[model samples]
Target: MAIAKFAGGWAFNSKAMVADAWHSIADLASDILTLATVSVSLKPPSERFPLGFGKIESLGSLGVSSMLLIGGCYMGWESAITLYAHFDPESAHHILEHIGHGHSHSHSHSAADLGIPSLHAAWLAGGTILIKEWLYHATMKVARERKSSVLASNAVHHRVDSLTGIVTLAAILGANALESAAWLDPVGGLLISIMVINAGFGNTVASLYELVDQSIDKEVKSSIRKQAQKALANIRDGHEAEVRDVSGVKSGQNYLVDLELAVPGSWTIDGVKDLEDTVRTQLAAKVRGVRRVRVRFLSRDAPDDKKYAEFIPGSPGALPEEEGSSKQNDELVDGHSDKHKH
Candidate 1:
């Protein structure tokens, strides 16, 4: 009720009122849909879908944007037709007179016919477009931060809405001012249609890309690398740690990245387990968007003779003099040292 009152108070012209109402309804619907979709996506079974609920949100955004684009174009086309017909000057005059009469009630066609190209409507549409663009930016930021493909796609749809709105508003202004070149209105409408079609195509392309399991952005990869490195640093013998592979699966559209961490040989089972735990814990703490971390520890063993040479000075893969002697003694000090006593 309060919202309606505010909208009514702001709507001075019929065209303005119509445009405002359209935007208000669209915003309300989109907000409700977005919330519902997000809630569903967060549910337990959301991951059951191949593309997850992200695509659903994306589709919803695309639908709303397409509607706005089409409606704007239609309005622009009609205005062009009226302008080309050199719409009855008396109608325009009558509209002005009616407005002058302070009849703040309903506007009749007689008044509408006389209605000059609605600059107020154009401004309102343009402002709405800007708002959509702002929403897109905000949503996209959250998506990127969360690594959510669905939100990103929805943001793209919002971008298209904003672009179409801009084009429509520009056409409206041109048609009103250049009444002589009234064809601009229809041209503007046609351009808006083209933009809508292009946006649809873009959405399809994005969905396909996600479906193909395209590699994530470089920044995301860098973040993963950094986290892996941090995890490696927490291990006692992590000097030879290397990342084998980092792949993510989208179950129901949610991301779950699996990381393979290769470490040096000579780490015992307990040591490996500890390293894995450290890696997982450190990654969870340091990585901003990583929901889970699965660590696969790999050990690379040198040949037995090669291992012995690591401690023998002047031997083919031996350590330096003092260190080599110390390592050899350390290896022999263990209870199992007799097994290699020969």
Candidate 2:
């Protein structure tokens, strides 16, 4: 409704209106499609589409982004062409005066009249570029929060829109203000196309990165390891135990981690089970981001104590009983041993 009001009240040329209307419709349709895709993706699946359709939602967003990019590029091209036609500035000034003064004037103005203050078609092209940029950021934010690839891709289109706006604005301003450099308009349009292409390429690279299941950052992995270590400490032999693998799966806003632990062979089956349970329970209770934990136990042989025999020898510290006896002591000291020999 607001758009409609703007469209009606603005002193824009017919071509500008058509271009704006097209851009607006495409953006609206993309938004609606994204929402619908998300809903369908979240729906329970049947036999035909067995896998939960969340990924399809992303694909839908990608498709919408592609369309938006194409439309934006086309609009940019059209604006460039309008500038090349060398539209009259007097008509644009007249419309501007009418809009600024808030007066309805009955002057016949063609779409060509919506040109830049000095250049041909600058106003229409520049305005479209600006609008596209605004939409891009808005959509990107939504996509990032939802973790939707499609939305991110669409957002790239908006970035391209912004770049194009810069080119168009510069070109129009240059042509109008400096007649010597009138060729800048078309050159700027070409540059805008290149920028859009570059953005599209970037989106493709990002999508491929996501598809490859890339490893997370070292800092994040280290943090998770620290949390796991902290959680495992509650177990009996957990302090000595070695943690091998920790795999996590996202469930809604939370995460579930499966841990593999290596413990000593001395630990009984029941003891190992208890340790496993302790680790899982402790992690679930103590870890801030951990929603669930599954622990797997593996037995490890304890190091042999015999290897350090020199450091811990086996020997008796007590003297011989016969030598220590009182009778033996008296016989030796008082000549009692001689009487026994005789």
Number of the predicted model whose TM-score against the real structure is largest: 1
Candidate 1: stretches off by over 4 Å:
1-32, 44-120, 126-163, 250-253, 302-342
Per-candidate TM vs. native?
0.54, 0.47
Question: Best lDDT goes to which candidate?
Answer: 1
lDDT of 2 by residue, 1-342 (tens): 226513531433333333444445555665677667766765665798554454454455456546546765775555454454445545444554656632342232333343433433456566666677788878888988877655785686566445555655676567568745555554555565555445445544443443343433455456567766776675555787777766654332234466667777677788777776666666656554454566766565644323224364445785545755978778676796677778
Predicted candidate 1 versus true structure: per-residue lDDT over 172-203, tens digit per residue? 67767875544454455456545544544554
Task: List per-candidate RMSD values in Å.
Answer: 16.6, 21.3
Clashes of 2: 2
Give the Å error, residue 175, model 1: 1.1
**Residue 28 local lDDT, model 2:** 64
Candidates' C-alpha lDDT: 0.56, 0.55
